[model samples]
Target chain A: MTTTVCGRCKSSGAVTDHQGRQDGAVVWTILRCPTCNFSWRDSEPARAIDPAARSVDFAVDADDLQRYPKILQQ
Target chain B: MNDLPNRARSISSLRDFLELLEDSGQAITWSDPVMPEPGVRNIAVAASRDANGAPAIVFDNITGYPGKRLAVGVHGSWDNIALLLGRPKGTTIRELFFEIAGRWGDQEAQISFVPEAQAPVHECRLEQDINLYDVLPVYRINEYDGGFYIGKASVASRDPLDPDNFGKQNVGIYRLQIQGPDSFTLMTIPSHDMGRQIMAAEREGVPLKIAVMLGNHPGLAVFAATPIGYEESEYSYASAMMGAPIRLTKSGNGIDILADSEIVIEAELQLGERELEGPFGEFPGSYSGVRKAPIFKVTAVSHRRDPIFENIYIGRGWTEHDTLIGLHTSAPIYAQLRQSFPEVTAVNALYQHGLTGIISVKNRMAGFAKTVALRALSTPHGVMYLKNLIMVDADVDPFDLNQVMWALSTRTRADDIIVLPNMPAVPIDPSAVIPGKGHRLIIDATSYLPPDPVGEAHLVTPPTGDEIDALSKRIREMQLGALS
Candidate 1:
C-alpha cells in the first residue's frame, strides 16, 4: 500500500534506492508538493560551510512552515 | 540621484548587479570563462569583518556576467544603518528595535507627493510580454535551482479582492522562478506574512498584484521583509527606520510602489492553490525541500534608470539571507524580550538551516536564566526551527560565535541547560516531524562566578582586534621589504 509517491521526482516514480548521503545518513530528502505536483528534494546546500563542520543536522520532523507541532518533551 | 540598487547613478536601462564588482586590489579578475549557462553559474555572498568590526560582504565577479553590477553587501553594515537612520549606528540593536517596536510620540506617515517626477523607477518601462531574462540581470546561481531565480525580489501588491486593502501593499521578498516568457511564481515561504495575505486573497478570489523592490539599500530590503506584528507593515517600519517615510507611488492595480526602488517588477501572484517551491539553498547551509506554495504570475515590469538587480545566496551563515532576514528579525525579538527580561542583552538568530538560535543574556538571578529561555522560545515569530538556544551574560556579544562558544565552554554545563526534545517540530528539519517545528534546548551559560572576581571585566579579553591587525600589517610589511 504505497500511500505517497517518491518525493524527489514527485511523479509517484520511485526506484529502490537513491544518492546524496552525509555521514552515511541519507542526505537527500525527496518531497512532493501535494497541489502543484512539483517534486523536489532537500539536498545538500552550497553556501560556504564552516570548513570545520561538514553539515548541520536537520530534524526530519521540523518540516512544517508553521510551528509544526512536536510531541511535547517532559 | 539614487537609481537602482547597487548601481551607479544615472545609467541607461536595466542591468544585473554583478556588473558592478570592484577589484579588491587583486592581480587579476577571478571570475571569467563561466557564463551563466544552466549549471556553471553561482553567486557567492561573503561576510567578512570591516575595519569597525562590522560585517561586509563581497559579491565576487560572477563567471558569466561581464560588465554587470555585482551586489557585494546589500545588508548595509552598521555604518550604512547610521546613514539610513540619520543618527549614529552606535545605537545597539536593542535600542533600534525598542524604538521601532515602541510607540513613537505622535509619529505618522507624512506624505510628500511628487507627481511622477523625481522618481528613478521611471527610467524604462516594459509592459506586457516582458521577457525578464533579457532586460534584468538574472543568474543561474546553481545547477539545481529549478532555474534562474531572481535571488532578490519583493512584491508590492494590493489585495485584488478588497479595494479597501489597496494601500496595504507588502514588499514580499521571494525567490522568483522564471517559468517562461511573461510568467513566474513568487516562491516565497508559505508562512511569510505576504504568503498568508495572498492565501486569504485567493480564498476570496483575488489576484495579488505586486511591484517588487530588488537591490536597494540593505536597510530597506532587509527591514522591509521583516515579519512584525500582524497589523504592522514593513513599509512603515522601513520608513521609521530610515527616519523618514518610505516614499512610494501607486503602481498599476493599486499597489503602493517604492519610487526609489532600484528595480520594480510589477506583477501579480497567481495565489492559486499551490506549487512546489524549493530545493533551493536555504540559509541554514542546506537544501530546503519542496513545499506547496503560492506561485506568482508576472504582468508587467518597470525599473529605475539602468537598475541593477540584487541577488542573495542562501545556504550559509554569511549569505545574503542571513544578513538580511536573520538580524532583521532578531531585532524585534530583542525588543519583545525586553518587556519581560529587561536586562536581556542580545538575541542571535543563528541560521542553522533555520534551526538553532543562540541568545546572549545578562543573568539577573539563578531562576532568571530559564525564564529568559522560555520567553525567547515562546516569542511570536516563525522560530519553529530554533533547536539550540544559548543564554550568555550581557558581556558577551551574541553575534560573536567565539564569545558564545567561550560562554559554553567556561560557564555552561549539561545540568544547567534546559532541553525540550520532541517539542513542536517542522518537517524540513531532519529531527522534527515538520521542517518549521522542532525540539528546543536552552543552554544557560551565563557566568556564575564568585562576586569578587567579577569586578570590572579587565582589559581581560586582551586587545584581540588590535593585535590581529598589527600582526597582519607586520606580515604585509615583511613581504614588501622582502620584495624590495
Candidate 2:
C-alpha cells in the first residue's frame, strides 16, 4: 500500500480512498483529505504488480476534467 | 477629516484597477487565439483557481472579435480585493469588511459631472441597428443557462416621487438577462431599493427609467452592490472611497452614468411589462428556476471605440459574484450592528454563497452575542436573503470556514439555536415554502459562561509561527510543476 499526502493541508497519512473504479487503461480514484476536509480525484496507469512489489505514491492528484464532480454542491 | 492614506481609500476606475493588478504581477494577459465557447470561461476559471484568487485574467485575442478583449476574475479573490482596497497582501475578507463598516457613515464625497463629449463611454453612440450579440461576444459559462447574462451589470434608478431623495439614485448590481437585442429582463426583488423605486414610479403613473452600466471601475461596482440607505448615493460612496470625485455624464434620458465605463445600455421599465427571466446560474452555485420578471426596453446603446466586455463567473462557490454580493451585504450589515453593539469586530456574509452570515464580536455582556445575531437578521441587507446567522467570539475569523466550523462544533448547542419561521423569504431559495416566506435560524456560538477558575486549556496546536513562515518561504521559492 502507498501513502499519499494531501495537497491542501500538506499532511501525510490523512487521505483515504472514497471510491475507485477501473476504466479500460486507467484506474480512477477519489481521495478525501481528513485534515482539510477536501476531496480530489486521481488516476493511474493500469498495470499488474507482484504482491511484494513496492508501490509509488503521488504528491498531487490527477488533473482530469472528466473526474471532477459535475455538480459541486455548496 | 480623512484618516486613511489616499491610496488606501479607493480605486479610480476598472481600467485603473486592472493596470494596478498588472503592475503588481497579480494579473495575467492571454494573447493566444481562443473561442468564446468553452475556452475563455474555462481558462478564466482555471487560472483563478490555480492562482488561488491571486491573478485576474484578460483575453486579448478572442477568436471572432480580433481587437476586442474580455476580462474576468478581476475581483474574484480576497487578495485582489485587498489590493484594490489598498490593504496588505494577506488581509482577510473579514478584515476588509470591518474596514468598510468603519468607514460606512463618512460624509459623502463630491462628484463631478462632465459633458457627453468628454466621456469615453459616449465615443460611439449607436442609436439604430444596435445588435448586442454582434457587437460583444457574451459567453455562456453554464450549459443550462437560459441565455447570455449580464452578471456584473450596475443598474441605476431613482425615486421619482420622493422629493427628499431627489438626485439620490440607487445603483445596484443585479442579474440581467439579454432576452433580445432591444429588450432585457431584470431580477429585482420587491424588498430591494430598485424594486421600491419601480413600484413608486408605477404609482406616480410614469415608467421607471433605468440605466445599466458595464465595465466601470471595480470600486463603483462594489459601491453599487452595497445596500446602503435609500437616501444615499452609491456614486458618492465610491468617490469617498477613491478619495477623488468620480466623473459622470448624463445619458440621453438624463440618468447619470460613469464617464469611464466601457459600455452603457439606457433603458426604461414599462409598467405591466413582464417576461420570463431566469433559469440562469446564480451565485448559490445552482441554476435559479425561471420566473416572471419585469422586462427593460433598450432606448439607446453607447460604448467606447474598442471596449472590453467584462463578465463575472457564476454557478459556483468562490466565484467573483459571491465575493461581490458577500462583501456588499456584510459591510453595511456590520455598520448597522456596530451602531448597537460597538464590540462587533468583523462579519463574513460571504459564507455559503452569502445565505449564511458569521459575525465575530468581543462579547462584553452575557447575552450580547444573541443580541448581535438577532440584530443581524433584522437589518435591511440581512433580512433579505440571510437565512442562517451565527455569532462567535472575536478570536475567531469569520472568513475562515475551518474556524467557523470549529466554533459551531465547540461553542454551539442545539438548545441554544433560535428558529424563527414564516419570515420574509428569499425569492431565489429553492427551499422556500412559498414565494416570499421562509424560516430563519440564529446560532449563538459565543461562550456564555465565564472563564474557568484557573484558565482554559488550548486543545489543538498549530505549527509554530516561525515554522509556518519558513514553510511559506520554501513553498514560494519552489517552482510550480506543470499540470496536465
Candidate 3:
C-alpha cells in the first residue's frame, strides 16, 4: 500500500488509524492532515458504535479514502 | 548571561531581557520537538491565551533546524509588559499610561554606539550570499498567508535629509515577507514615516539602506511601534523609559541596529521598487489584501551565536501587537488630549489593536467629555485609527471592558451618541468603505450631573472590597471541581 500524504502540506507525514483498522469503515473521528492545525470530525454513522469497546485504531476512518481521494494512493 | 540584574543594568540588549525574563520566572523553554510554521504558532497562541498569561516560550528544538530556537509570547500578558516597563506588580492600566507620559517629556536619553568588535549581532556574519530561510526557520503563522512573515521586525532607517529628529533615529515595525533567497517585501503605508523615508531616498535616486533587527529587548519593539512624532527619535524615548541608554552598532549599510539584537538583516530598499506583498493576517483580525509594496534586497545577514528568532501572533484581540500598540499609543493619546482637557485622567486604547479608545475623565466642567472626544478625533495619531471614543467618568476603569459597557448602557443615550461620518480610517480597518476613509462614533458615557441643584449624582453599587475579598477567600478554600 502506498503511503498517505496530507493534502494540505503535501507531506507524507499523514498518519491515519484507519490505515491499521482491520475493518475499513468510516466514523466520527478526528482527521488531521498536512500543515494546518485543523482537525475535522467525520460525520457520524447511521448507528452509534460502542466507543468504549472500540480499539485504538478506530480513530482511522476508512471513509477518508473515498472522501479525500488524495488521502491514500494505490 | 550577564551577572547584573536586568533592571539594574538598564536592559541595553535583547540578551539582557532574556536573562531578566528567566530571573523573574517569565520565560519557559520547551526542549521538546516543535515543528516550524503552524506548529510553533499553534503552541504560541495557546500559551498566550493561558488564564495566567503563561511565561514567554522558547522552543529549543525546532524540528528541522537543529541548534536553532524561536521565542514568542514575550509581551503576552499585562504582567509581562509591566515587568518590562519596570512597573510594580498590579500596575493599573491608568498608571501605565501615566508611566509612559511621565517619561515621554524627559530629555532624550543617550544611545551608545558600540564598536563593531564588541557587537554580538555581528559575531557570525554572512555578507556575500545568504538564504534567509536556510539561516532561520521563517515560520508561517496563518494557514493561507502569502508566505512566511517577520512579524517582530524593527526596520531602522535614517531620513536621507535628516537622520534623526534633531538627532534621534527612526525605527518602525513593519511586516516583511520572504520572497526569495535575498529578497523581501516591506508592507507599509506610503504615508508612514518609514515609507516616507523610502520615498525620499527614492526621489533622490538613492537606495534607502534599512537595518532590520529581530529579537531585541521588548522595550525596543515598543519604541518601534510607537508613533513618536515625525521629529522625535523613538530610540531616545526608549532610552528614557528604560532609564538607560540603548546600545547600538552601525551595520554595513551604515544604519544603526540594536547592538544586542539576536539577528540583523541589512537590506537596501531600491528606488521605485514595488511588489505584491500581503493577504496576511493583520492586527485587525482580517487579511490585509494584497497590494503593491516596497521590495527590499538583502545585503547582509548577521546574528549572535545560537540566535533565537522571535515573532508575534497578530490576529484579533489581546495579542502582543494589540497590547504593545495599546500601551505604547495610549500615552501619546493621553498627552494629546490633556493639552485641551486637563480633566482627562487616562486613556485606554483597547480591542482591535487600538481601533477604539476609552477616555476616562473627571468631568470638572460641563460637556468636557464631548470636548475630549472632539480633541481625540482631531489628534493626528488618534485621527487615523481610533474609530470609537467612549468617554466615561473617572470612576470607571477603561481597561475593564465590562465597566465601560456598563457606563455606556446606564449613562449613555442615543441622542448623546455622536457620529462623525466620512472620517479617515486606518488602512487595515476592514469596515472602511475605502482603505483610509470611514465613519467614527463618539459615545458619551459620562453621567450628566447638572449644576444648580438639578439632581443628585447617580450611585453605582457593587460588592464591597472587603466582601469581595472574603468571598474570594471562601471560594479559594472550597474544594469545587470541574467548573470551579
Candidate 4:
C-alpha cells in the first residue's frame, strides 16, 4: 500500500534495547519502521548467536552489588 | 518476494531511529545549548551506577550544525529497557532473561526506495562528497577516542555461501570507524554472528550485501547488538515485547530493503580483505585495541524523509552496550538457570569492575548451591563474561549490589568456595581468565545448612500491603532511629 510514513513513525528504531516485557518476559527484538512508525517485538534466536557453551567471563561491579542491599542475602 | 520494494534499512541510521523514539514516548527533546560532545553523555554517566538508569536526551541546537539533531541516553533506565522489550515499566533483569532464553527470532527487515520518491533525509544532502566532519556535529565523547568512531551499529547482510541462511538474516550491531564520507572500516568483533556471516561469505568468495542501520528506537539497537542464538530473529523478539509486528519499508537499490528503519547505507564486503579500524572506547570501559579489519564500499545510501543519524556512546561503567549486555544478554542467562533450578532467583551480569559475579539462589542441597554456580558458567551469557561467580540465597536479588556483597561478607568461606581458573573470555573482561581464556572460581556464598536447617527463604513473606507500608513509614517518619 502506497502511504506516506509519518515523520513520527520514521523517527528511529521503534523501542529501546534490552527492555523488560510480559509479566515475566524479556525484550526479544525491538523494531520500528519510521514510516507508519511501525514498531514491534520478536523473540531473540537462541541457536544462532552464542551457539555453544562458549566460555566467557562476567565482571562483577562491587558497587552494582552494593546498591540494593536489602534484597541481597547474607 | 512480497513485491513493492522493501528497501533494506541498515539497522544503523541515527535519523530514522529518532522517529521511533518520538512515537514510543521513550524520548523527549531538550532545547538546551549543545554541550561539548563528550560532555553530552554525562546524563548517562550520571546514572550508570545502576543498569537501565539513564534518561534519553535530544540536542536541538548544536554549536555548528544550526538545525541538525543529536540523541543520547536511548536505553538508560530499566523501565526504558523494559520499554525496549515492549513490556510495562519496572521489568527487572531476571524477567527479561526468561524471555531471552525462549528464542523466537525475526526474518529480515529491509528497506526499498524509488529515485522519484523525495525522502526527508534529502532535505540537505551534501551535493558534493562532504567531509563527515562538515555535515554533522560529530562528538569527542571521550579524550581517548583516537578519532570519531561511530561506535554503535546494527548491521544486516545475507550469507553469500548458503542460500538457506538468506531469508532469516539477523541485524547485528557493532562499531564503525568513520574515516571519510565514501569509506569506513568495519569492526565486527571476532566470532560475532555478523562477523561470522561476513567471514562465511568471504571464505566462499561471494559478496556480502550490507545495510548499516544508523539510528532508531534505542531499544532495537540493544536487540541488534545482543548475542542471542541465531535461530530466531531479534526483531521478532522485539515484536513479542511490543505486542505487535515491527513495521518496515523499502530503500536499498537491491531487493533486500528494510522495514521500519531510520536509514540504510548499502555496501558490499568481500571476504578475506582486512583494514585497521579502531581505538574508540569499547564496552569493556577500555580502549579497544586496533588491528586490520574489513573495509566495505558504500554502493548507495537511502533513508526516510528527515533521517536523524544514530550514535551510541562507549565509556566507563555504562554505555548502551553495557546496558544491552546486562539487561538483554545477561538477564536471560538467569532465566535459563531458573528453568533447571527454580530457586535460582536473580542474576546480574556486572561490568568488569569487580569483574566477577554475584548470583542469588536458594540452596536446596548442601552441594546444590555449587551446582548452580557451575551451571551458571555454562549459560550463553554467563560463559562469555564471568570469572568468579558468587552464588547467594533467594533472599538476595542478584540485581541489588549491596545484598550480594553482604552475602559475600557474611556467608562466604574462602575454602568452601571452588575456583576453576582459566576459561575463554571476551577481550574486555578485566577478570577474564587466561586474559581471554582462563578458569573462574565459584563461591558458594548461600547460607549453607547452618546448625540444623530453616525452611527455604522463598517461603518467607512476613507481611503484605498496608502493614508493610505502615512499617516503612514508621521507620522513616517516626523517631525510630534507636529501634533501627
lDDT by residue (B1-484, candidate 3, tens digit) is 2333257337766667767777778788989876564578788778767523457888877655667778888777765676677764345565666677787677557788889878998999998867786576556666545456899899888778666433445788999987656778888765578877777777777667788999986788987787767777777777877677788888888887788899999998866756545557888888776555677899999999989898888775557676666778888888878888888888887567568889999987556788888888777677687898899999888877998998988888788888899988987899998877999999889887655233536685776455775676466557444346
Worst 10 residues of 1 chain B by lDDT: B20-29
Best by DockQ: 1
* Tens-digit lDDT track of model 4 for B1-484: 1210121121233443344445456567767654444355555466455554455667766544456666666665565565444454445565655544443332334323433234432233333353444333455455434335666667776555654553457677767665445545677644567767776776667777777766654546766655567665666555443333454443353423344455566677745655534445766676654445676766666555545555666677556556655655555666677778888766666455224667777787776888987787787666666677878888776766776887788776778778675677776554454335766778887776754364324444555455765676576546657666
Model 3 interface RMSD, one decimal: 17.7
What overall lDDT, based on C-alpha atoms, would model 3 receive against the true structure? Answer: 0.71
Which CAPRI quality tier does the interface of model 3 achieve? incorrect
Question: Candidates 3 and 4: which is better by TM-score?
Answer: 3
Task: Give the TM-score (vs. native) of candidate 4.
Answer: 0.69
Using DockQ as the yardstick, the better of models 1 and 2 is 1
True contacts kept of each: 0.04, 0.00, 0.00, 0.00
Every candidate's lDDT = 0.53, 0.69, 0.71, 0.54
Candidate 1, residues B35-95, lDDT tens digits: the string is 3332223324324233122333332343323344444344424433322333343444444
Instruction: Assess candidate 1 and give its lDDT.
Output: 0.53
Query: Each model's number of backbone clashes?
Result: 70, 2, 1, 151
| lDDT accuracy of residue A58 in candidate 1 | 21
TM-score per candidate: 0.69, 0.78, 0.81, 0.69
